[model samples]
Target: MTKSPRFMQIKTYLLDKIESKTWPVGRRIPTEAELCEQFSVSRMTVNKAVRDLVNEGLLERTPRLGTFVCQRKAESPLMDIRNIADEIKERGQLHHSEVLSLKAIKAPEDVAMRLGIMLGGDVYKSEIIHFADNTPLQLEVRWVNPNYAPDYLAQDFTDKTPNQYLVDNCPLSAIEHTVEAIMPNEMIAQRLDIPLEQPCLLLHRRTWSGDQLISAALLYHPANRYKLSARTSL
Candidate 1:
């Protein structure tokens, strides 16, 4: 076969480094001039290649900070999805997270329908426990649409909550929230560091960008440890 276009060659070169983690998440990539010099191609071609990767979520650009290898700001609990960190900061308490699990799994029927993907489609799932002053505050269980955030599985959420990451990386257009009281299961109770008999508050939230379902989450908080509040403006 004939050799591909210079831009294609350039794109593939950068993609290889990213996938192999040579350019890890949040690692700043070379500038257009740098790539132009390396590939001996015009700046326009390099820019086109970089722009394509950015649109694919493989690269991200900041106004003054330069482009970096995108981390796929996926689940791993956009760490402050519950705004737990901010709440703790406001109270002058230290905060952190216990990431229970992060992986890629085939979506079940109900989850697929809610995420607007076909059954068995790829989805990113994560479980996390948010802490306030070293006390468990909430257990966040989330499923993310892979299409919206293609590198979802490669993200490192140890330092941030899924909600915080997504909010920063992906622009959201809509949200639906529901809250109810329930007795958490054995696993959830243990993660929340509470007894199964204790009632828990479940916040089921579905987020979307326009008509596309971006993610669905179940935030479970111990009734005694946490309270739910809402604000409204008329």
Candidate 2:
């Protein structure tokens, strides 16, 4: 318990830098010596935090160079974001989805807190695997506010993506996305056909149509096959 908070503090500091885009990918971070001074911590403490991030694919260490933020596996625009289905179609790839589960359930605490609903309130949950040209590309797990999409569980996801349906039905005002690298569990690893050693790009998204939170989603992609890119005008 004593070591937990200190290491977490160090980890949170670095993660905040990456998540806020303050320390963009490819930017070399401060050396361990520098971090020790900045955080007033010991070398071993710094090493533990840094090593954990390296394993998560957030930081890369070179033989002589200091640690740097590694590239994200999938990129979306900072302002405007496109639905995954449309992105695949634009690339001329055959896009298909396999809906694994669709049903109404009580909102989990984490989800309810984000959606501004009761902890046990009804929410529609959807688990889907998206394929690009027959290759497993994404595992999409989404939680929907039934108040926004009452018929979410009744619709067939294979015909239209959960994201697309929400876009069509809701009046969107804001979208928030947080990207992180995560090592998958056995189930996710097997489903993605990727080894546990490989880090997966995990994107957490929350959508709001005006004042109502519409949906929250966790999107996962194998790191080797996916990278987030954006091209936009100033």
Candidate 3:
């Protein structure tokens, strides 16, 4: 296995602390000198870690001011799964999507385990940027278990939402969702028309049909413009 770099490891450690709330938002982190001593690395290494986190929107730095933990944005609920087109229609807005990529690829280890398949199993991947009223809303990255949806790549995603197509073609039993807050990478930032330092809401979902995993998806949305909601009953 390829080990992460020293700077990356440091970044992960700091991120874990932030995520675990050890260092809450608006709280200043250890000074550069302090971190260099704690990690037993040079100032350059510590600076790199901290700089990357700032670029990733996990930390904020001011000139002459210390670096502080960033506050997590209020996330909307995505408890209920809905088609993007339907969502926009319900809100009386125009919905559009551009197909970025659609092809078959070998599933990676993480994706394979989630789909309950071999690491190199065949899977269909689709990437699309969903828009509302000409403004980018979400970046939809999906992997379909070909066993369930054989012709997944042949459909015209520009005309129909993937959720709509799946609902029409595949029988679904249950769906799993994992939502998180993250900073957009260069690619995602460019696609979503947001700054790389802006935070984004990531929704990772897996759909199952009759005990079989059907699809896994990563939905990315700009935090400032997009919000999700869900209703639950006791």
Task: Give each model a TM-score.
Answer: 0.63, 0.66, 0.67
Question: Best by lDDT, which number?
Answer: 3
* lDDT for position 181 in model 1: 95
Off by over 4 Å in 1: 1-82
Worst 10 residues of 3 by lDDT: 71-80
Write one digit per residue (lDDT tens) for candidate 3, span 65-163.
Answer: 899998433234577677877777676678889999999999899889878899999989999998887878889999998888898989999898888
Error of 1 at 179 (Å): 0.4
Cα lDDT for residue 99, model 2?
89
lDDT of 1: 0.81
The residue-by-residue lDDT of candidate 1 on 60-84, one tens digit each, is: 8989889988643212132123456
Error of 1 at 212 (Å): 1.8
Q: Write the per-residue lDDT of candidate 2 for residues 64-127, one digit (tens) a residue.
A: 8779898544345645657878877777678899988999889889989877899999989999
Candidate structures ordered by TM-score, highest first: 3, 2, 1
Task: Report the error of model 2 at residue 122, Å.
Answer: 0.5
Report the poorest 10 consecutive residues by lDDT, candidate 2: 71-80
lDDT of 2 at 180: 90
